[model samples]
Target: MTTPTLSRRLVAEGLGTLLLVATVVGSGIMADRLSADTAVSLLGNTLPTGAILVVLITILGPVSGAHFNPAVTLVFWIRRDLASREAFAYVAAQIAGGLAGTVLAHAMFELPLVQASQTVRSGAGQWLAEVVATFGLLAAILGGLKHARQAVPWLVGLYITAAYWFTASTSFANPAVAIARAASDTFAGIRPLDVPAFVLCQAGGAVLALAVMSWLLGDALRDPEVA
Candidate 1:
């Protein structure tokens, strides 16, 4: 099989992020419209997001490691699995794709194309939730890839699904996603003012995961499986 070029990998990252965010934002919109109960709406939002994540990661993993998240790409860069320049490119693509996805979701639902979120996701509890959520997400990816590469997709999907329920902030766990979500005013939205805290917590979580995984898994951090 021919190895994919850098351009191809970049495209995969962008496209995967686009679809992932679309699933998240679009499902949230639909769920909010369909259910009066907040819990029911959340359940409606969670399932499709998880399922689509599994599909996207499974299909795009080989192409670009299926990062679709700036935090994940930053982790790989820290581990030296990806070069700095490439990592930056991946992050940029993810952010752009995420914005596009949020816009697309609004357009599809006939909502305004752009609107700042009024949904305030703040407080110490929510920040802690983001930290824990992101830590678990990275841990699942690294551990699954180390022990069972084939299971990484499902592991990630399930983790996010559960995290949605357990975490106060519903596990945004991703900087790019958080930024994009600030533009949305629906169920999945987070106020633009709240994004910095969430992103900071996410970054901290990624660092924690990298350190813990490096210690616990030892050489697995450097294993080709991660690549």
Candidate 2:
């Protein structure tokens, strides 16, 4: 197969972020309205979020490397999996897609678009949680891709689901996703002021994951086992 161009990668990032944020905001609204219990609402958010993640990954992986998350881009950039120029293009597309996704989600749900969430992320614990969540997400993405190609979507879905359930931060590992999710005041939304901290932790996680992956998959990095 021929190598994909930077423009192609930007398109993929744009499309992937669009679908991801739309699914997240859409599912969060549906879950909130449909479920009476808090548990069910959370589960409802997770189920669709996981499903859509797989779908998006399946569709966009080949074109833009399916790097819907800024953290993933950073990790790949450090590892030489992606070029600096492509990384910049992907990030720009992801941010644009995030804004567009928020707008679309609000319009679709008839919800008022706001810059804050009902829930605010604060405290050292939450910061640590963000780190853990991003680390796990990057780890899964990097390591799982080693042995399996066709199974990527399912693997990503499972990883996301587990992150949602296990991490206190609910695994908003993607800086683009977190920023987009912050565009609304819904259950899935986060605060704009809180975004910087979370994004920082996410970057840190990516760096940590890169180091670990480098140590563990030195051969794979030199000669990739999976695309």
Candidate 3:
């Protein structure tokens, strides 16, 4: 297999991050304006987030590999799907794109430069919830690519959607995403101070998933049983 270039991967990562954050921040502004004050309006935001995620993965999966999340990139690196250099580049691009997206969202909403969203996520249960949610997410991404290559992006989208509602943390499984959300201060954003806890849980969860996936898929990876 021919290796993808760093320049190419960086471009894909930038585009993916831009799209992800735009959809999130834009939908958030729209939802708040439309719903005013009601749980029913929240779907207006979440629906778009899921849609963008699926679209980016499908469009960019081959090029930048559609990591979109630092955790996802880290998992791939662990699994050898990505090189260390490539992984670091992708992560940097993700962070830059995320910050750009947040700034754009702030501009669109006419919010202050430093203004932040009010969304709250915390507690041990929530932290553990993030772990489970991220583990499932990483597992889905890794397993799909390894065993069920055809259904990769679609299945990942479904996993995120489900994890959002099922877990107490609502599946903000990506640190780049978590950081971007904090900027918008939308329904999706967590506070800057709260970020460490969420990121820590996410990282722990991803590491755990990596361990388990390796054990189960190691033999398959070594042998290439899929025909």
Best-to-worst TM-score order: 1, 2, 3
| RMSD from true fold, candidate 2 | 1.8
* Backbone clashes, each candidate: 0, 0, 1
Q: lDDT rank, highest first?
A: 1, 2, 3
TM-score of each: 0.97, 0.93, 0.89
Tens-digit lDDT track of model 3 for 56-95:
8888877777888888877767767676887798889998
lDDT by residue (tens digit), candidate 2, 96-145: 99878887888898877555676788678778888888887777777777
Error of model 1, residue 126, in angstroms:
0.6
| TM-score for candidate 2, residues paired by index | 0.93
RMSD of each: 1.3, 1.8, 3.0
Best by lDDT: 1
Clash pairs of candidate 1? none
Residue pairs clashing in model 2 are: none
Full-model lDDT, candidate 1: 0.91
Regions of model 3 farther than 4 Å from truth: 221-227
Q: Candidate 1: where is the Cα deviation over 4 Å?
A: 223-227
- Model 2: number of clashes? 0
Q: State the displacement of the C-alpha of residue 88, model 3, in Å, after optimal TM-score superposition.
A: 1.6
Selected candidate, larger TM-score, 2 vs 3: 2
Q: Highest TM-score: give the candidate number.
A: 1
Candidates' lDDT values, in order? 0.91, 0.81, 0.78
